[model samples]
Target: MSQSDADAIDEGVLADARAEASVAPVPKGSLWRDRNFLTMWSGQALSQFGAQITELAIPVLAVLLLDATEFEVGVLTAANVAAFLLIGLPAGAWIDRMRKRHVMIWADGVRALALATLPLLWWAGALQMWHVFAVALVMGIATVFFDVSYQSIIPSLVRPGQIAEANGKLQSTYELANIAGPGLGGWLIGVLTAPFAILATVGTYLASLVALMLTRDHEERRAPEDHAPILREIGEGLRFVFTERLLRRIVGYTATGNFFNTLATTLLPIFLLRDLGLSPASMGLIFSLGAIGGFVGAIATPHIVRRIGEARAIPISAIAMSVGAALLPVAALVPALAFPLLVAQSFTASFTVLLYNITQVTFRQRITPPRLLGRMNASVRFVVWGVMPLAALLSGALGTWFGVVPTLWIAAGGELLACLFVVLAPFWTMRELPDAHSASR
Candidate 1:
């Protein structure tokens, strides 16, 4: 599809989403009050929290146990995120053709099987770096399917007016998982080896898969005649993301932020272990503090939105993100205050991220058409998340040459530059929600 054709389709889809938002409303209720939404949310939350544990565990395994180089650790991280760059768009296209619930269920099952392999391989004394890479790749691929389907399903499950509230609840659980999962994973790694500690993650995935199976919903059906060639289909998604004024601006801002943030995170473990001289338990404690901040941020989002409005909330969050990034390198200079600095950074970072995510996601859902939700989400994700591997690679190389502390300083500076994106975008000044009826017209 040409760019113009894609734009036309997106406009049409946005019209449909607005139409749905204006009518076909569900009753106002707690997401917990809906059995199906609760089940789905619970399963996804378990899986997401488990993934957070592995995020810390995998790097700790390579560094602490194997004495891997910074470059090698970077490669491992890259392997995990590479799928988002390579498979995200295709997964979105595929998801658009199938039942989203089935996609999520299968994704959970695949991740469970992959995580289970890690512990078994370790027990057999056959675990190698390549095995880790392979598992990372598989899990990353599964995540693409899971995330795309998950986003596509949200509007179907809740009333339009309740989307923000629903998102806040989901973010709160996710933050709680972040609070518990990494802290526990770090503690587990302290007692058990990193490999065995991963068993908890495997168990979490299994629970998620079971939960997905038990949740029931009406299956979605796509139009038979809507199918197109692979290249054309991919082009359509890309076109919608890049050509649409609102989506394009969002994609640019988020992609830029993620690129710099990933750079900082990729070097964080190295900095903590080498420069700050923190133990695994302490590292976990710091991350747990951040998660607590995230939890508070999630709970506070609705109030923040009501007070400042979504438009103001975005820039405020961006400023918070900048401040958090800037504080990371400062932690190195004050070694005695390392943990405290990290706690502060994590708190602000988590809070800012949740607020930004809830606002953007809710706005996108309100504006996007149901039929195009999967592809649109995938397109945005492909652009925003695809930069992670490159960021990891660059950060690793920088750490290898300049040392972790210096690299952190550079990454933080880069993150501060990301604030310019919001300042320059049209979204910065736009605060009011578009009326569903007017948007549809």
Candidate 2:
């Protein structure tokens, strides 16, 4: 087929897919009514909860057990994000060529096996900083594969009208896991030590593996084509995301928000523990409040999106995030307000992030070709997520020079600045879904 013919065919397929997505009536009762979606959702939820346990445990292990300095802890955090920068596009390309379900299953299995080794090494007295670093990098690589494939699979499983609802459900599950996992992890670390506490995460990944295996679905077939070089494929994905006007704006705005958020994430634990002299249990309590906020936001997002429209949702949520980000400095100044500060931060951040995610993801899914979904998702994440490590490093360096409190003020200021991106962009005026249907006509 000629290029124009191929474009026409793609447009036709998208039209049919969008119409089906827009009007497919989902049953109102049990989520399990769609057994495949439920299975996939449940598996991912379980795995996310498990991942959170380790997310807390790893830093705790580094901070409390190994006596890592602020900079070292930041490096450890950066290590976690490094794989997304390095392997993200390639992983996405590979995912586009294979069965997403199988990719998810293998990814889960890899994370489970990687996590399980931590306990083994701890028992053998062979665990070290490098060991933790290695595990973090591997786990990150596995996550890249799982995440890229998972996002691509959702559109195939649900109708278009259901995308926001499905995404809200998924976010709710993740938020619930966040609420439960860290609180539970703090208690586990208090009782069992960080290494042993991480064993729980291993079990969680195993549960996900089993659930994914039980999920029944026909494998999606790929279009026949010659494979391009990995570098060229990666470049194509990057170009598509950057060249597309909507995606470019979203990426720019999201990347701005994420950079500051990541800076805070790298600093928060150190700030709470080192400067404020808060215990792990207390820190966990405060963090759990944020999770509660996330849960509320996630559950409410679909309705909120429907009510206000996706475009308006972005700036509203962005303002909330800005307010939340600015509140971090208050927690530092008035230690008595730490809990309340955390609550505000959690609530606003969760609400804003959910709105941003639902809008951007739905738009991207609508615009990108199905065959390119994995790479496109990964490539965008590569840019958005890739900055995290650099942010961590910058935060750590700033903390080292100015102390944690000053560093946090700077980070919060940076986050507040993110609002400018949205305020200035055309996204501020976009109050509804684009004229996607017109493309078909």
Q: Rate the local accuracy (lDDT) of all candidates.
A: 0.73, 0.72
lDDT of 2 by residue, 95-193 (tens): 767988888889998998987887888788887888888888888889878876776666667656565556657756766776887787788888888
Report lDDT (Cα) of residue 177, candidate 1. Answer: 71
**Tens-digit per-residue lDDT, 71-128, candidate 1:** 7777787888899898867876677789988888888889889878887887887877
Quality of model 1 by C-alpha lDDT = 0.73
Candidate 1 off by > 4 Å:
1-42, 153-171, 220-223, 244-247, 299-309, 362-373, 425-441
- Model 2 lDDT, full chain set: 0.72
Regions of model 2 farther than 4 Å from truth: 1-42, 153-171, 220-233, 298-312, 363-375, 427-430, 436-441
